[model samples]
Target chain A: MTEMLRVENLRVEIKEETILDGLNFSLEEGVHVLLGPNGTGKSTLLGTIMGLHKYKVSGKVYFYGEDITDLTPDQRFKKGIFLAYQLPPAVRGVRLKDILKKILNIDPKKDLPVEIYNYLKSLDLDETFLEREINYGFSGGERKKSEILQLLLAKPKLALLDEPDSGVDIDSLKLIGEALRKIAKESNLLIVTHNLKILDYVVPDSVIVLLDGKFVYKDGLEIIHQIEERGYDYVRRLVYAQNLS
Target chain B: MLKTYLKEIRERALKAKDKPAILGPDIDLEPYMRTIEETPIDDLEKLPDEIKENILYSGITPSENDKAGTYFQINHSVVYEKLQEIYKGKLEIMSIQEALEKYEWLENYYSRLIPPDTDKYTAWAEIKPTGGYFIRVFKGQKVEHPVQSCLYIKEGNISQNVHNIIIVEEGAEVFVTTGCLTHLKDQPGIHIGISEFYVKKGGKLYFTMIHNWSEEFHVRPRTAVLVEEGGVFINNYVTLKPVKSIQSYPTVYVRKGAIARLYSIIYGRKDSYIDLGGRLIFEEEDAKGEIVSRIIANDSSKIYSRSEIIGKAKGTKGFLDCRGILLSKSSQIVAVPILDAQHPESELSHEAAIGPINEEEIEYLTTRGFDKDEAMSTITRGFLSLEIPGLPKVAKEQINYAVAQLEKAGL
Candidate 1:
């Protein structure tokens, strides 16, 4: 099996406050779920891995065994790494079609290709939605759908999605989950989610528990059942016992 | 009657030429008074290659295809003026001097909306006037294509004073695209333009102006519009090139059942100082007015965007929107929007915002495969792309062409 992503002793600080400290993790080429509590720096970890400039990062991030910690976000994107933001910013005057044209290198005078139109339909979005300002007035479900649509268009080697199931309705979750499953068939997916509801639509190969900026436990789908029944405090105590031993 | 009106206005202008304007830096008129003669050309192909290229940059095509009429002025001469044969009697295009000599009734609209003594620039335009276009749309006729005009300044260190008049008769509609530019890139020059537009009852007029002047040009354009009852007027203005200084505030009066909208997209670059604004007055009941302005200030440029909407009659409505972006540390942008409602039944509102480009937006674009510079450029172009309401197709195409040209010039 080939390693898709590896983070070695990663420490992230935003505005001089440490958010993720001494985090170490590695993932293979498959679908993985990241489970954490609120404010556990799940989004921050994803952003740091994508090379967002806001975070003060110290440590190493490897994509397919290549050092990528110092690369810019655009440079990282060119190396086949992508992140679906937890909350996408609203760019007031930039239309979705305009950005799509830039991403696909399509001429401004030509229409968007048919595959994107098919993706729009599968996401239950109108064709006219491409003309709207990007994320300007989108609903919660619509924003998630837009992220998933972009993921399908990009087809990167590794995808980092933050809480793709949080604000989505059940129907949109099914659509987005199906899209992620399709993406995972060709690319590795590391998704941050709070609940097991999304698990019903897309099965994961492994589930990792992150507590206090470090991975506490890693297991198959059975770990999610334990966490749901006994909660993260149980896992915390179990990890504490192991550390003491 | 035309001769008498011209004489009286010229006298007033002479007396007020020394008077200072209410805003912007004052300039001495003595240096620019020296005129250089340019021979008139009946065909556009006779223009120099550099001159033609500059005109094209301002959104005017030398071929004149798909246009209702074409007017070209170089320095103080009207080089070419032609109207498409298909629009023979429905549309009229000629030099303002010829129109004044040919029709006596033109005196009514010559300086009616904007007084010659309103400001020093207007005064200078009347005192040492150059040739400008006189366009008219016949009653009950709607011209499909826009009439294109190019005002080019070939000689440096001279003032090009021009006065233009546009009249749309009752139930008629027309679109006019004007491009103002200069051939010299670094020589000192000044252009004073006084434009008056009148829209009769049930008439519609769409006016688009693109300015592509050089770095050392000082431009002062005074424009006013009078819309009769049930008329509509839409004005679009774009100035993306470098200029030494520019100050303009076009005012419009909307009567009963009339509507007026003014849109301005201004990009200030390279030490340019631009003070652009517009005012709309609702004069009677059921009148509507709107003002929208988008400004981008870069490279130590300074811009002041001002908009005012006054509602004086019952059932009147007005709104103003002003947004700007400062791309450089030294660049400055000031937005001032004012709304006054005199009548109890009138409604007026305004919105103004000025700040640097959003970092989050830049970061978002970078994650979508754009480098830093490309991300910034994309955001800048998006900032200037405004969805103007009620604009004709031809006018929109012209504005798009102007923006594309600016982009090609590394904007």
Candidate 2:
């Protein structure tokens, strides 16, 4: 299978402060879980890979084997790389459905598919939210699901989701994970999240533990069980020893 | 373009010997043959720059400093000369002198509608031979379409004394639109115009005007409307660039139970200065009047608006609303709303709001792939289009076209 995304020795600094230090990673055509604690540069890595200007990256990034380290966010977006931000923005005077339809380039004369509305309903969004500005007054979970709705329409080759299960309830979380597992099979998934509760639904093939801007371990689902009980102390010791060596 | 047009008009005037619609002193040419035979033509090349600037500043009407009789130079004057050369016999237009000489009956009613002391510009314009347009819609005669009067100001430091008297007789309705324009390549110019509208009892009159002048020129406009009982009057005005200083005050006086509405919008940019407003006075009971004015200023421009709604009737109602937007840090706008209700039963309401565009909204739009400039343009159009529901179709289209041009200019 062809590699969807590849990062080689990625080093990023924000205002002279190092965020991602010499990170190297790749994703094939399946589910890949990226587990990390707070302040571990998970979200920063996602932003840098997506070409968001909030950080200054100093390494090469390749998408579908094409160099994209200097591409703008819009240019990268047009090349089929979607990033689901942890916090969605509020756009006033622009209706939610209208924005989605325009961005997706759907036909205006025809009705949108019922399956999309069903997904929105499953995520606890209502008709009023669709007519209002995009995420103008939405709650945390609703905003997340709106992002997912955009993801389903855009259908990017690489989906980098930043904490998809952070603010969702149990039922909605299950629905979101299920939706991802079903639709995300056509592309490579790079899930950067702290919570492991969604793993039972997504059922990752491999799990990587990122600490201090570098992956410390690569294992299977058993790593999630180990981290849940042992509480990242061993990983912290490994990160310290690696820094010293 | 101008030279070609002027040549055609000169040829037409020279060929037509039959006295065609003369607008100045009715000289038989046979009686004053010797005086016309000796008038010098070399002095007509162009007025001196100092004299042009002086006339521009002093409100360009001819004066008699020397008691040399002056010979009543009809063809040399701007109003009579231009009217004689172009559009002489096509339309029913006349200079004040010509009207007094030939149509002498009009002198009693010409400046009577807007007398000399009615305002400062009128008082000063009364010196020269003012041009007058007497449009009388007969009783119960409703013109199927509106009549248009196009006036152009070309001479430097020349005061265009136009006295427009529109009489809508009883049970008659007429729509009149006047356009005042100046060519782009013309020298520095100044115009002082006076338009007086008289709506007789049980008649309707709609008057609209659009003014476009070069920013180097100074303009002072004074117009008035007197609506009798059961009469309706509507006025709309717009001012554009190339005009340096503009001071306009359009007033409406409506009788008992009459209806009046005034809508005005002014956009200022690039060192422009304006002090414009409208006034409405109610003399009878149950009268209704409303005025809404919006102004936008940017780039070291200044605009001050002072409007008033005076109600003397017992149960009359009036509303005054003014809003403004300041785009640049150097721009300034101030509005003063005044309401004087003499009777306790009368009502008046006033409101105003001024601020910049919100930062959060701009950021949101920028994040969605639009740049800061595009976002600002969209917000400006949306803000101005909020008043489109009440305007007529042609006016609404004009506002939209103006906004498009502003965006194209990257404002």
Runs in model 1 deviating more than 4 A are none
Model 1 agreement with the true structure over B182-261: per-residue lDDT tens digits? 87987999999889999999999999899988899999999999999999999999999989999998999999999999
- The CA-based lDDT of model 2 is what? 0.63
> Candidate 2 lDDT, tens digit per residue, B100-173?
45654554455544545554455444443235455556667665444444445554545555556677777777
Write down the lDDT of every candidate, Cα atoms only.
0.88, 0.63
Chain B TM-score of candidate number 1:
0.98
DockQ of each: 0.76, 0.11
Best by the DockQ measure = 1
Interface RMSD of 2: 4.1
Indicate the docking level reached by candidate 2.
Answer: incorrect
lDDT of 2 at B381: 54
TM-scores, all candidates, are 0.97, 0.56
